[model samples]
Target: MQDNDITVLVVEDDDIDYMTVKRSFSKRKIMNPMVRAIDGVEALELLKGKKIGYPYIILLDLKMPRMGGLEFLEKLRADSELKDTVVFVLTTSKDEDDIHYSYEKNVAGYFLKEEASDSMMSLVDMLDGYWRIVQFPTK
Candidate 1:
């Protein structure tokens, strides 16, 4: 894959979860860059950076400190610059409201964290395929 094939930004607060994701990516031999943010605020700042680069997919955790995922999504969705970025909520929440709200905000996908790691890997692989093989509108 080219350097710009797909960049992933993982917005998660839990350190353990972050490590798990890293380990999973390594185990699966994923070659894509995986940027990380501990909270929504940091994620936004990172996304706004001039040199950080575009994130093809965001693995978001809904419940986080320094602004939750929903609030972050609301702000991002309303922003003209970031509205088109693909966001995928990866959370443990099974709440109907969370799901509905995330979808309403135009998230590209949602996945339960408790599901098997293999399932998560499958999604990541699919995402890689989409971003690497499919043509998307570029800036």
Candidate 2:
């Protein structure tokens, strides 16, 4: 699949972080469509609805006002339809337990939010290259 064929579902509550990601995408010229959710509950709603298409990757944050990322991952994994969805944890939490739990839930990767914007741009670049070569299951 091509990079444009992949969508990014950013499940985060921090306005700054969200904007940072948006800025990073813009700076890197990553034109992939992006959808934002304030928390896990909203993310789930969007996923269950038809607003976003398949072959999407989730950039999930672990902490939020409502349902947290781990809770969301649990619910998501329980659902057969969404269990195989690709998810990457992007959060400020550096707790080992959080990392363990996220990996246990089968996240694609875990990243710290303290990373520099240059790092973020690199991440976007990597993701663009990744989606271009990887294949996602048809929904």
lDDT tens digits by residue: candidate 1, 15-88: 98888788877776878788888998998898777345654678899999998999999988888888888888
lDDT string, candidate 2, 1-139, tens digits: 5668788999999999999999988887889899999999999999888577778999999999889999999999998888999999998999999999999999999988876677677678778778888888777
* Global fold similarity of model 1 (TM-score): 0.89
lDDT of 1: 0.82
Looking at model 2, the pairs that clash are: none
CA error at residue 58 for candidate 1, angstroms: 1.2
Indicate which candidate wins on TM-score: 2
Superposition error at 39 for model 1 (Å): 0.6
The superposed Cα distance between candidate 2 and the true structure at residue 43, in angstroms, equals 0.4
